[model samples]
Every structure is written in C-alpha cells, then in structure tokens.
Target: MDTYITNKIMAVITTASNVSPGGAPVFKCQSKDDLYSITANLEAILDGIAHALNDEIYIIVKH
Candidate 1:
C-alpha cells in the first residue's frame, strides 16, 4: 500500500513539476527535516489504516 501510495504521489508531483512554470510547483518543504516530518505523518496514517483493517471488533464484543 505504501508503495502504491508513494508511487502515485511521486507520479503526480513529477507531472506537476514538469508542466509547472520555472519547474517549481507543489510540495513546499523548507528543509530535509520538514520532509522527514511529512514522511513520519504519512507512515502514521498508513499504520492507522492497517490497524483499522486488521481490527476484530464484533468478535471481541461477543465475548
């Protein structure tokens, strides 16, 4: 899923940059640390999705 999502994001960003004026467009991060922060947030979102999918709610409630 990460691969799918990251690839899609990259494709979109790449396309935008190519057609963008002066080759500058989208994803404005001030520094590498900011980029890392964004990645950490993305990982947390993916982790939440995984946990939600793997959750067994009804089974636990029945007991």
Candidate 2:
C-alpha cells in the first residue's frame, strides 16, 4: 500500500464524513486535487476506503 495513496483516501473519508449528516457510515472522495493525484491508482484508494470503513462504501472521485 502506497503512503501517498493512503493519505489521499484518508482525506476523502474525512472530508465526506464531515459534510454529510450524522456522518453517514460510508466512504466518500470528492476532492479534485486528490482525485487527480490518484487517477492512475484509483484501485488503491478504493481499497483503502473499503478497509478503513470496514464496510461497503461509496466513492465520488472528481476529475
């Protein structure tokens, strides 16, 4: 697992949970910068989200 990729995923989860009501039990990624950084390694980010949430989650990667 790449540290850069991990950090990006963490950023996504943090941002999404903070914006959503009740902090829904789902993973989300909506940062264009972050998305662009991990465009070539999306699978790693997605995998990180799944592992971090420990449940099925949604990912919204902005181009």
Quote each prediction's TM-score.
0.32, 0.20
Off-target runs (Cα >4 Å) in candidate 2 are 1-27, 43-63
Model 1 C-alpha lDDT per residue in residues 1-63, reported as the tens digit of each score: 353332222210111223342322233344546544544454454442211111111000000
On TM-score, the leading prediction is 1
Residue 56, model 2: lDDT of 24
Question: Global CA lDDT of candidate 1, please?
Answer: 0.29
User: Which clashing pairs does model 1 show?
Assistant: none
**Candidate 1 segments whose C-alpha is farther than 4 A from its true place:** 1-26, 47-63
Tell me the whole-model lDDT of each prediction, alpha carbons only: 0.29, 0.39
lDDT of 2 by residue, 13-40 (tens): 3334444634233334566455444433
